[model samples]
Target: MKVKIYGEGAEAQELLDKVNNSLEDLGLSDFMEVEVTMDEELKNSLSISKTPALIIEEEAIDFRDTIFEGIVPSDEEVKSMFISIIGGGGESSGGCSSGSCGTCSTGCH
Candidate 1:
């Protein structure tokens, strides 16, 4: 999954915890691979230009503030979102591989 949230501080850490707790409560915690930080090297490597950004498996999620504005995606919601994302032909967005089963792969996102 390789999830990275680009930012650090009490607020950022709090948001990270919220994300973890929310996901875990729904039993979808394993669906995510989370890393919290705002290191310059990490920002550059992840191509992040804004704080509070999220990179999911090499794909840029776009908004930095939006993700941490106290909003989190539900498991089914996340799944549906990625379905559209991958179907649009944008790097699979951590979904299934065509060679593996020709369908969404066990909700790898």
Candidate 2:
């Protein structure tokens, strides 16, 4: 699994630390690879409009999704998201299995 955190500045750093701690506490620090980026081009390519966005990329499949944006998510939320993604089963927040119901901003469909 590959995780990307996009942002620059103090708030971004804080979020990064929180995410890292959560990953460690969840015992995912060894299995997952993380990258913190401040590249404007990469952020624009991902259409990340807010700072401290968390993107998860699954290596077993051609799947990449943004699970968090803007506000920081709780440790449990982070763990749940990872579990769902890794397990390949979860209800979509957009009410569409494909995640393209026009309600989700991640553009997963």
lDDT of candidate 1 over 3-106, digit per residue (tens): 56667676566556655664576555686677776578756764655555544553455433222222333444444434443364354444332223234323
Model 1 residue 98 CA deviation (Å) reads 22
TM-score (C-alpha) between model 2 and the true structure: 0.69
Which residue pairs come into collision in candidate 1? none
* lDDT top scorer: 2
Query: Please, what are the lDDT tens digits per residue for candidate 2 over residues 17-48?
Result: 77788778777789888888877876777788
TM-score of each predicted structure versus truth: 0.45, 0.69
User: Which candidate tops TM-score?
Assistant: 2
Assess candidate 1 and give its TM-score to the true structure: 0.45
Residue 90 of candidate 2: its Cα lDDT?
Answer: 53
